[model samples]
Target: MAMAITCMLRHAVTTSCYENPANGSTSYFKTLTPVYYPPNGDCSDFYVPISIDYEQPEFNPKFKWTDSFGLQSFMAALTARASAPVPEQAPFVNAKQFKGDYEIAASFCTPRKPNGNEKKVIVATHGIGPGRTHWNSPFKPEEFNFVQYALSKGYSVFFYDRLGCGASSKADGFELSLETAKAVLKTLVKSVKEGKYTGKIKAEKVALLSFSFGSFTTHKAISEEPDLADAIILTGFSNNITGINGNGLLRSFVPRIANIENSARFGDRDDGYLAWPSVFDLIMNYFKAPAFAPSTALFTQSAIETFTLSELLTFAAPANISAEKWDKPALHLTGELDYIVCDGQCKGIIETPAKEMYPNAKPLQVSIQPAASHHLNFATNATGAYGVITDFLDAN
Candidate 1:
């Protein structure tokens, strides 16, 4: 018998009902409903066939198993060398076409009642592993939905999975790289501008919002296009990666094929996919003493998705962002306790690194969530993060 896998994006309603804590009755609230666009309509999810060619680093098989104790020790010695600032490398000149056209899956949501500016839209992208689901919490949709918050503030949101993860097309994970990711994002932004997705909405003023690995892709894409987005908001990200307890976090991911007992949760995921061990959820996602209920972390672990090797490599690569060319409004928000980006404290008199990276941006802001972690949107203080984002968007 085939294993049963839950599709997180199956809901199609524009509103969700939440039980009011004060009363026993339930209250209906507007939520981000699933909507289909051109090409693949209600019959299937939306997908775009994009052909792109870019030079990418050849994959080294040895890097995959380098997380062992001995290797970790060896890598530790080279940490300083690895962290040494290096000038960004230029895009590969010997670019080759990716094996086949990439089919990207996207989800779109609009405010229940448009406040009249349909052209103003925000394009959100998720990090590695999960798809757009990372932007909102499924278990407590009413309380922890970023997309719904943005919609409630009157901005339509367009979010999708990168080529190799989530419901998007699958291929040799090695084939998905930063160059390809940038190409995919460029296409999506252009499509939105052209009103290709839905004839009903045309984007005139656009903002780019991204998390973790998605932020890296967005940085490269916006750098290349320059004017693709009018404003940018980067979450679960920082210019520094050396501070992260990488080796510890890396050990938590075992090859998906090795987790057969939990096959149903992973579904038919292919090789090159990394599965998160439930036992390490606390160390990996939550703080020692979490602010939210323990149930929230459990739900997050159960809903965790698989990540691709290529996506990992893309993020592991040295930062080669051309921020000097970014002349729009930009915001960088991360968690105070973001173990992955910050060594646990993202606050204080820390400089706005992006200001130096994106010197030309009209105005740049940097902020840290008080008691949050790498997964800012899912953290207990997620509302604070949302406030920072929406406030930045409104000001810009």
Candidate 2:
């Protein structure tokens, strides 16, 4: 109670309202403020400090593929990696109560012209490769930025860096699991609802827009809290609970130490923070060509962000598979060629599982954006995919 009250009383970040897209009436700013928590914001005491403890892989970053006798052999430890990992096959840690004055580096924005959707807010969670900028890309904003697109369409956005990334508070990477990530997200949702950290936007409707691991975090959140979202859109997602695609994702990511791969940008981060070794790794895992532009793929060399190994180790095969009480609308958008989740084809593989997971969600729709990969926003036809998402949000 004390922590929540303290955080509540703390002054919100000060910054100018968003005005760049001059015609629209919204505003913008970046700030780090305290993020308090509950295990489940609706069910638990919202004021309690939340601590999440879960099993984690003992997979040390220092150990090479060779150290495990080979990459193939190391795969055995995580052989059962899926939506709900087979316990024996997992490589991990083990234990939750909640405690923390965590902080998030967040950017809040609203639409300019008053429209039916201006009060609607999308809480976006980016995948491993980008930060909050994934939604508001500085690189060719018009063609690829979802944030600018949403604002232009008369909606609001609350985007932020996940803990241990960008300007957000950094923690021991090994201790940062998806459970903790989900709790952080839930806390942020509560604050966003109260207009606490987000420049007091006081959103009328809140939707969850998630990609890749962020999608996993969203799934975890809704599994227990049905009321967490009004609408949910998951891109770069699939119900890969079983050993899907021969474990192609982990092999491609090849988890390299961030500092070793790009010392300049990641040298300050700890060893647990990981980055893929090369553009090839990203291309293999996140991009599909000739569907995507070469320049865009090349641009990823700069856009790439480091993520934690613990997140990967803990994300798959969630214990709870259903969001029975969530009767809202859902859009499961993925690239037809999303190699990571769909294993290069989305139609048959991704649809049914997503449907099964959100069985109670009314008007649940699964869309496979043609010619794109896991990085849907970076695709050549990204705007097309973005349209599908925004349209769903508007209608639902």
Candidate 3:
């Protein structure tokens, strides 16, 4: 079951179980008896070398934010250029292939005891927020942890930081395009399915899960390599280009050059990386009042990470494509009040993407979790969303 993978895992991160999904209360759902995660000796941390010769756009990362007006102008131009095809008339006008080994940090975990669903695993990639921790949150694990929920349901979880975030190797931000993101994810899927870590996930049935920005990368990877995963669940995202308020949400970031804004955390990065300058601005982009706890917001700020300029310049372009080549199961789940994706009303808007993006999902499903925002895991009603995710897995 060997594949195009090269990496070694580090010491197990969990010798003991920290949280149980059954601890939380929800009238609609119930979890199984808790099991010690990692099962005595299991691999947790990893650094995989992803080598790809991907074509990336050319851009001059020389703009300086002189004032708010300057920021608005830059955003407007960025959005405009992102929509244009490669060989864009002016900005990002040319393309060239950049290939190398990028060391990506990953965490793999499974239940100590096996069940009917044991070999089934979910490989998740996070959005622009935190890193892999977005799915395995630390502030309140019972209420916020997706890995715990999946584990209780007898499924393993493979989570990783994207190429240029967290403990992963940092490179020229412009080199980290959507294509690169797709390549990294595809390789990870093969690694998990082929049992790169342990026999636990080797040849296992895999599900690809993505949040917000990571959703597009998942969408692209599956389209290019149709059978990489058995099921696809895109949370905190949709292909509704018209309804998604990306510009407004991005402007709310008050995006600052990552190194300039928070030198302490992002100083290692260059001007090609960007981050939100304020905590509240990020809140407005992701959360809805009373739907989330204050501590959740604070935890999110503490975990915030930087994104790249190339990523921003290429995000909008993929919103227009559907997974036409895929004939497997697919689901698009999101929060009803996702301020960033739906502009605060996702009721009627969520259904359009089901037809447009995943028309070939053997039996495509869409779940609009009530009273939540883009950051579904951080919501007070998070487990409810997690239930819908697992239920889809259970059925498909």
TM-score of each: 0.77, 0.78, 0.83
| lDDT tens readout by residue for model 1, 1-396 | 011112224432222212221222211111123221221122123676777666666554444332335334333442334455643322223445554677777766666577764467888888765566666545565556787777767777787777765566765654567666777788888888787774467787889999877887887777777889899888877766555555454544433431242444443444445555553554465443475656556555544555654565456353435488888898888778776666676664234555666788888888877877777776777777888998888887
User: Candidate 3 local accuracy as lDDT?
Assistant: 0.72
Query: Model-by-model lDDT, in order?
Result: 0.61, 0.68, 0.72
Candidates sorted by TM-score, best first: 3, 2, 1
- Give the winner by lDDT: 1 or 3: 3
Give the residue spans of candidate 2 off by over 4 A.
1-90, 96-99
**Quick one: best TM-score, which candidate?**
3
User: Candidate 2 lDDT (Cα, whole model)?
Assistant: 0.68
| lDDT value, residue 95 of candidate 3 | 74
Q: Specify the poorest-scoring 10-residue window by lDDT in model 1.
A: 21-30
Return the TM-score for candidate 3, rounded to 2 decimals: 0.83
Off by over 4 Å in 1: 1-45, 61-99, 245-248, 252-261, 265-267, 286-288, 316-320, 348-350
| Winner on TM-score (2 vs 3) | 3
Model 2 TM-score is 0.78
TM-score of 1: 0.77
RMSD to the native, candidate 3? Answer: 8.9
